[model samples]
Target: MKLRIISSALLMIAIVGAGCVSNKKFAQLQTTYNDLLNQNRALDSKYQIAQRDLSGATARVQSLEEQIASQRTGLAALQAALDKCLNSTSQGNTNISKLVDEINASNRYIQHLVNTKNKSDSLNMVLTNNLTRSLSREELRDVDVQVLKGVVYISLSDNMLYKSGSYEISPAAGETLGKIAKIIMDYKDYDVLIEGNTDNVPISQKNIRNNWDLSALRASSVVQALQNNYGVDPKRLTAGGRGEYNPIASNDSDAGKMKNRRTQIIITPKLDQFMELIEKAPEPTEGAAAADSTSGS
Candidate 1:
């Protein structure tokens, strides 16, 4: 009976020891679980902070990309503007060169016209001097010699050239006509026109109707005398008449009537010279023509 009691006491002590070991192992496991949970929370917080930093970096990158795109657009616009400005400058240079050439051509043409006029004036002066030197003072009283607009005019009184109230050439007129014809023959390039003038008085001659007929007949007589008597070329002579018109003086007095009853010999250069000058004239530019018009006004 003592052996059975000792066995029962030992078994009870083993049971108590087993129960204490189980409680200690369970507490250690709980402590390990709490530590693991705290580590997981800390890791989650770090991951959230990292994610926020990444999001901020992404937003900055997007902003930088947008600025770069806007800068590229502005650069393209500036390039287009620069190219347009360069092209316009080239065109402006071309226009300026063309304008300079036109101005040079116009200046040359103006100088040519001025030179031609000077030569014409010199020739007219020489012709006038020669005619004056050839005629005597007494003969010049009955004749009026002058130069007008590059032409020579020799006006003779009716009394000196014809018989009284007649178209017939007088004996005294031969010396004067011969001397005048000699001077005309020296200038082969000149053309001659014989013009007759009459007073307002009515004619009483036979075969002569009115003043027109008388004046025309007188002009014809002078032209015939130059061609037939004075050995002048008929092709170079033209006959015209002013019956009671183209008078140098009034028809109210006797002296004025005498002056009106006269004949004129006009000498001039051929028509071809004038035509050549006209054909050589250059076409004017728009700017030059406008300037010329403004200056003329």
Candidate 2:
């Protein structure tokens, strides 16, 4: 009876130990499964965040592309308008020159936008419009007016301005000068350069010795008229005598000689921004300067 009781006790202990081992293995497996579930949830959350960012980035890129395409279309339309304005005539309407200038300025602004990332060109546009309005016309029979790069050039026939072999301006010429003076007075921010040119013929007067002297005296006479008669500020005027050096036509023909004898009044705007841009631009080489010297400014 004692032996049987000892064997039964040993069997009960083995069964209890087996039950503990199986429960320990099941607890370890449950902990591992919970860890894997947590890892999968974290991975899914990261994927959703990445997808949301990609969608936002794609929308921004598409918006930028649409804006660029719209800008290109606007630029094309502006270019066409500029071409039309330049090709049109400057008759019937007195404000045609001003219109053309405004169009040109608008085109330039658009071009600037296309070329660079910058702001407004309002001041330049206003100045150009004022100048165009003051000048008014391109052709005046004996006078020709042209504006380029914000400078105004008025070329008058010497025959219309002066008598034969005289530096005196005729009464008829005073009317034209009066108009010019009014324009100058209206746009008070310009500096005037009066350039006198002559034909190849030799000149001999009581005080004038040569073509240079004649040209100089003629230019001085005009300046005096502007100051004394029309009240143009003397400080704004500069006189230059080109003589027969810068001729527009051949000296061999009478008609050509007539065309060669002219006086040029160059009106330049006094804008600091324009001067700064010009200063920053690349200087012309010696060869280019020589070629340009052949032409009148």
Give the number of the best model, judged by lDDT: 1
Lowest-lDDT window of 10 residues in candidate 2?
116-125
Q: TM-score for each prediction? A: 0.58, 0.49
Runs in model 1 deviating more than 4 A are 1-93, 148-150, 273-297
Q: Give the per-residue lDDT of model 2 (tens digit) for 53-146.
A: 3554466446545655665676576456546645666531333344444445445544544343221233333554454454323224466555
Per-candidate Cα RMSD to the true structure, in Å, reads 57.5, 39.0
The 10 consecutive residues of candidate 1 with the worst lDDT sum are 92-101
Pairs that collide, model 1: none
Q: How would you encode candidate 1's per-residue C-alpha lDDT over 1-297 as one tens digit per residue? A: 334444554465466557776776656555555555555555554564356435544664465456445545644653454445446766433344344444455455555555545564566556667786877755766776666445678888899999878898998998998888887787667899999999999988889987888788888988998889988999999999889878867999998899899999988778885455342556767754554453356
